[model samples]
Target: MRTLGNILWFLLGGVFMGLLWWFFGVLAFISIIGIPWGRSCFVLGKFSFFPFGKEAISRDQLTGHEDVGTGALGMIGNIIWFIFAGIWLALGHLMSAVACFVTIIGIPFALQHLKLAMISLAPVGQTVVNKEDLTRKY
Candidate 1:
């Protein structure tokens, strides 16, 4: 099931998503100050390429970061991101939506990518985990 979904996703518009992520991730990493944000984009790109079998998890649960979105530093960073990478990522997903809509089989995967793209834009402290990873120790 996942294999089919992944193949369809790639055929429809996942390639665009991967390219966008890789492009921005490189741009972010090229600047030393954007390293952390670049890492987040790279992580998101991986999921964008193959997302059927995974889910996004809270980074706090995985990394034990307390007060991430609420702290002052987090807010400032999120605000800046919202204006910058956040919006671009959202747009990427929107483009995927158009690609998916062009055909019947592409619809479901397109919707999935659209949803995932929303999450990617401002991923912040979010983490992607396999759905069955609940059995694994964090």
Candidate 2:
């Protein structure tokens, strides 16, 4: 089911979103100071590619430790990201979601886009993993 959904998502618009994330990642990678953001973009790009059966969770939830990406610095980073790129990416997802919502069969895909939009707002402290992993953690 997940595979089918992912395939449909890719065929619909997921590939374009993933490419957009990757493009931003490459732009960020061009500067040493933006390496961290670039890495986050790459992670999000992969997540955007096949989001079904996966979930995004806080780094603290995954590692049980407060790291740079999950602390005060992460908050600052997310702020900077939101000011710079997050808004645009999230807006793009929202637009896609709206378009998908036009059809009943696209409702699931639209929800996924909404989820991705939330992640785009503050991706620095988050990690994407198999949904089953989230279940096992608690």
Candidate 3:
């Protein structure tokens, strides 16, 4: 079921979103100082490809300890990201969700877009994990 949904998502508009993420990643990479943001963009871009069976979670929650990405620096990073690329990416997802909501079959896709939108808003301290993995100790 997840496979089918992911295939449908990829065929519908997920590919475009993933490409956009990669594009942002490339732009960030070119800036050198934005390497951390570039890396996060690539990771989230991959996540955008097949989001059905996975979720984004805070690193602190997953590891039971605070890390650089889950601390004050992470907050600052998120703020910078939100100002630079997060707003645009989140807006794109919101628009996609709105378009998907036009039909019943698209409702699920719309929900996924909403999830992506939320994640896009503050991606720095988050990591993508399988639903099952989220339950396991890491």
Candidate 4:
């Protein structure tokens, strides 16, 4: 079911969203200070590619300890990201979501886009994993 959804998502518009994330990631990487943001973009890009059956959780939850990307620095980084690329990325997702919502078959994809929009707002401290992993303690 997840595979079918992902294939349909890729065929519809997921590929474009992934590409957009990667493009921004490359742009961020061009600046030394933006490397952290670049890494987040790469992560988000992969998530956007095939979001079904997956979830994004705090890095701290995954590791069972606070990491650099899950601390005060992560907050600051998220704020910076929100100010710069986040708003634009979220807007793009929003538009996509609205379009997908126009069709009954696209409802799931629309929800996925909405989820991505929320993630775009603050992706720095999060990591994507299969949904089944949520039940496992770190």
Q: What C-alpha lDDT, on a 0 to 100 scale, does residue 86 get in candidate 4?
A: 90
Tens-digit per-residue lDDT, 39-73, candidate 1: 88888888888888888776777666655643676
Q: Comparing candidate 3 with candidate 4, which one achieves the higher TM-score? A: 3
Best by TM-score: 2
Q: Write the per-residue lDDT of candidate 3 for residues 68-133, one digit (tens) a residue.
A: 456788789899989999999999999999999999999999999999999999998889999888
Clashing residue pairs, backbone N/CA/C < 3 A, model 2: none
lDDT for each candidate structure = 0.77, 0.91, 0.91, 0.89
Model 1: pairs clashing at backbone N, Cα or C within 3 Å: none
lDDT of 3 at 1: 94
Q: Show where candidate 1 strays beyond 4 Å.
A: 63-70, 135-138
Between candidates 3 and 4, the lDDT winner: 3
Residue range with the least summed lDDT across 10 consecutive positions in model 1: 62-71
How would you order the candidates by TM-score, starting with the best? 2, 3, 4, 1
lDDT of 4 at 78: 88
For residue 36, model 1's alpha carbon misses the true position, in angstroms, by: 0.5
Model 3: residues >4 Å from true position, as ranges? 66-69
lDDT of 2: 0.91
The CA-based lDDT of model 1 is what? 0.77
